[model samples]
Target: MVAPLRVGIAGLGTVGAAVVRLIEEQARTLSARSGRGIRVVAVTARSKAKKRTLDLRGIDWVKSPLALANNPRIDCFVELMGGSGEPALSAIEAALKNGKSVVTANKALIAKHGLRLARAAEKHGGALNFEAAVGAAIPVIKTLREGLAGTGVNRVYGILNGTCNYILTRMEQEGLSFAECLKDAQRLGYAEANPSFDVDGHDTAQKLAILASLAFGTKVAQSAVYVEGISSIAPEDLRAADELGYRVKLLGVAVRTPKGIEQRVHPTMVPKSSSIAQVMGVTNAVTIDGEGIPAITLVGPGAGGAATASAVVADIADVARGIRAKPFGRPVDRLRDTKKAPMERHEGGYYIRLMARDLPGTVAKIATRLAKEKISLESVVQRHPEGVDATDAAKKASPVPVILITYATSEDAIHRALEAVQRDKVISGRPQVIRIEKN
Candidate 1:
């Protein structure tokens, strides 16, 4: 009889515990699928005495993560300890050095040191699976790396962060302000006390970097992504989007362009009829545009112990089946270096909201500035006080909102025109700008 694949896991957090429980509950089905039994032979965590409901009766408790990684008895090393550096890095390297397959859900580490780790896995001839790193249980990594290996990917974009999506969804549906929604997200445990990582767009940037590499054969570079968070999005913008047949979403988009791959994360205005716009709340979705195949979108729970662990165990099962594909879809040496795409050259339609001064020539001045930058308006709407006439409102000099939808234009031109208008002092506060995504 073939021996069961022995597993050692580091970090007994929610995901690690779920992984153990899942393996135990699905042992029979796993054996049938993988053609061998799977066992959790050893485990380690920072605090072993921490009371957990787990049944570790026969499992060996290792002293530290590095020791568990180096444990010769276990055939696969699972690293749930998150971080871009230190114990997780060294331990993963040791596991790969020992020719033991490694599985992790650490997106930060993958974005930071993926190439180096991939090199180690390649040299040692062991699999380094991180399907949980991008979208939990979505199976996007396999779709890009293996399923679409024959097709050239033109674009891969998605709503990658759950916290941001939840916040935006509430803002659009309930007309809640960003700050108000953020506080509720914290109360509901969807956001961290220090929620800057998710709200400031860096979390989405890290995930986009990984997806961009997989789709384009470019080396993972978190620095290459242009990030803009949803914090600047306003309730008024969401209302305007509803009226204009669009929905505002925090999207991470990586598309192949004439200049190269353009990876960006920001509050995008997508058509209301589009598939991505329909996804709401904490759910996540990814859309891949390839050469000939119809656009494929995978949607599921982006994060959570059970959702994430499903992907983790799926990767472990691949190890049991002796499937060892290169870590980032291709050999590390074959992956090309990724560089940050210049945002100034970005071309797209824009939704601009300006608080224009209710004075004669104010409209003329704004139009002239846009004309100077060669930006043509597709549509424009001006709003006055509910009960006030235009003449009365203009006499009061109260600033009125003037919303402009522009045709395809470069980012630099929009900035230049807005700067000239700002200096002209015809508008109040900063202008609210959102890029439009067509389908």
Candidate 2:
């Protein structure tokens, strides 16, 4: 029988400890399947004396991540440290320089420096596996890097962030405001104590950037991906969406249009009947539209220690089995230069809500502006000023609310029409506009 493949693990945090436990428990089974045993020979963290749940008596404990990456006793480096630069970057670079295979769960690191690391790994003849970086337990990175390698993927997108999905799902179901749902999420540990990154759509955008590179074979560009959060989604919008047979989800959408690639993370209205719309709570779903094969959808837990560690162990199993593939599915030099399409060129349906002065000809004026911009409205619901149905309310008050769902139109047309409505004396405050996704 072949000997065990020595592994070095850095950052014995929640995910790190989970990896260790999983490897130990599944060693025999995995070895039989892979024809080689997998063992964690070396481990490293910030503090050597920190109390850990894993039994580390026989393993080597290093003081720094760099030491673990460069340790000669280990054949593979598993970086579970959660960061984009510094030690994580240095350790990964050191591993590649030393011709050691690497498996990581760092999404930010992949999104920011994936191309560079891919080049380094390819240049040094080392495997760079990061299935855990994009989707916690979905094997999405592997799907794009291997399964869909033969197909032409026009778009790859989904609910990449669980915290945002949790908050949005709660808001839609419980009719809670965005702030209320966010507070509940933080208390439930679905969101961080400082939840700006997840709630602001930046976290999803980062993951989308990484997926976009794999799907399109291009360099990851987190900054180029347009982003918008659910912080501004009001209860009224959620109610309006429900009334329209839709659900509001913070979706990371990417498309390969005739013009170029369009990537965005925003609060979008998806038809409630769609499979993705029903993916509620902290769960995540990714949809990939290929030209030949039917659209593929993966739904599962998108976060947590065990789910993420499952992905890390899968990478380890692949290494043990001698399965190797490019970091981004192709040679670094073959990856396309990302050509980001402008947001204005993005064509899609829209949901618009306007608070207008309750007076004669207000709706007519709004319709006229929309007509001038060639934006056609599909449906409109007018709520009485008393916040009740028009038929039930005896007397209508001032500043009535008007919600309209429009047909497919360019973003520029919608922006122009909304701008014209805001300038009119009939409309009150800025109009609320949310894009409607047809996924």
Candidate 3:
């Protein structure tokens, strides 16, 4: 019988504990497949006395993750400690420098320093695997890295964040505003106390940066990706979109164009009949378009301890079986430099909502601005005023809100026209604009 692969898991949080459970439950099957057993020999977290559900009596408990990473008994280092820097990065670096293979679930770390870490792993003759970083249990990173190895990938995009998805899904389905749905998500523990990273689309952008590198063979640049949160989306916009046969989703989109890559995370208007449009709540769906083959989409729970741990264990099993691949699917040196396409060059349809003065020429003025920019309006819906006071019409008139769906046009043109319309005296307040994506 082959000897077991010694694993050191740093961080006994939800994901870390799930990894342990996976190893325990799938031990026999994994052994049969890999011809070697996988065992967690050491574990580390901030506190040793913290109550946990897993059985840790027999395992060695280290006070710090750095000690676990450098432990002589462990052959593989599993980093479940989140955060882009500090103890997590330090431990990962130590493990690689010491010639131990490293497996991590840290998307931020991968997005920020993937190239450097890949190079380090290569120089040290150690493997660096992070299948859990991109899509939880969806195996998306592996799919892009190996399944589509022969195909030339043109674009990769998805609904990468669960928190924003949950909020937007609730807003559309329950007729709740962004704030109300976000509060519910937080109460349900789907969102963190500091939910800015997830709600503001930064988390999805980080994952998209990693996916872009794998799909297009480019260096990952998280900062370059354009991001827009769903916080600005109103319930009225959701209802208006639904009336037009569309569903609003927080979509992380990456497209490779002749000029460069266009990566963005925003609330998009998807046709209600589309498969991804139906992926509501905390679930995630990733779609990849290759040069020849049909587009492939994977949809499942994008977060949760068990799902994330499944991905982590899959990487562990691959390591045990001696299966190895490049971190971003190509040699680090061969990966092309990231060239970011400016946001203005992005072309798409748009959903615009504006509070216009209830005057006769207001509609014509708005239409003229859009026509001047070559943007055609597809549909317009005028909302009736409710709960208006008869005496306050002159002091604070509740102007009519006009919602319009526009035909496809460049983002620059749409912005220029919207700016022009907002500045016009006919419009009562700041106009709200959201892009429409045909997925």
Reference-based TM-score of each model: 0.99, 0.97, 0.96
lDDT of 3 by residue, 1-439 (tens): 8789999999889999999999999999999988899999999998887888889877999878899888999989999989999988889999999998999999999999889999888888778999899879998999999998999988788899989988988888888888898888999999999999998999999999999999888899998799898888899988888889998888899898777888888888888987788888899999898998888999988889999999999999888887768888888999988866788999889998998876667789999999999999898887756766534542454588889989889999988998898788777667888888775
Q: Say which prediction, candidate 1 or candidate 3, comes out ahead on TM-score.
A: 1
Candidate 1's TM-score reads 0.99
> Can you tell me which runs of candidate 3 are displaced by over 4 Å?
386-398
**CA lDDT for candidate 1:** 0.94
TM-score comparison, 2 vs 3, better candidate: 2
> Which pairs clash inside model 2?
none
Could you tell me which residue pairs clash in candidate 3?
A: none
Clashes of each: 0, 0, 0
Expressed as tens digits, the lDDT of each residue in 1-439 for candidate 1 is 8899999999999999999999999999999999999999999999988999999999999999899989999999999989999899999999999999999999999999999999999999889999999989889999999999899999999999999999999999999999999999999999999999999999989999999999999999999999999989999999999999999999999999999999999999999998999999999999999998888989999999999999999999999999999888888888888878899999999999999999999988998999999999998888996888999989989999999999999999999999999999999999999999987
What TM-score number comes out for model 2?
0.97
RMSD to true structure for each model, in Å? 0.9, 1.7, 2.2
lDDT per model, in order?
Answer: 0.94, 0.89, 0.88
Q: What are the runs in model 1 whose C-alpha is more than 4 Å off?
A: none
Ranking by TM-score: 1, 2, 3
- Which ten residues in a row are the worst by lDDT in model 1? 332-341
For model 3, what is the C-alpha lDDT against the true structure?
0.88
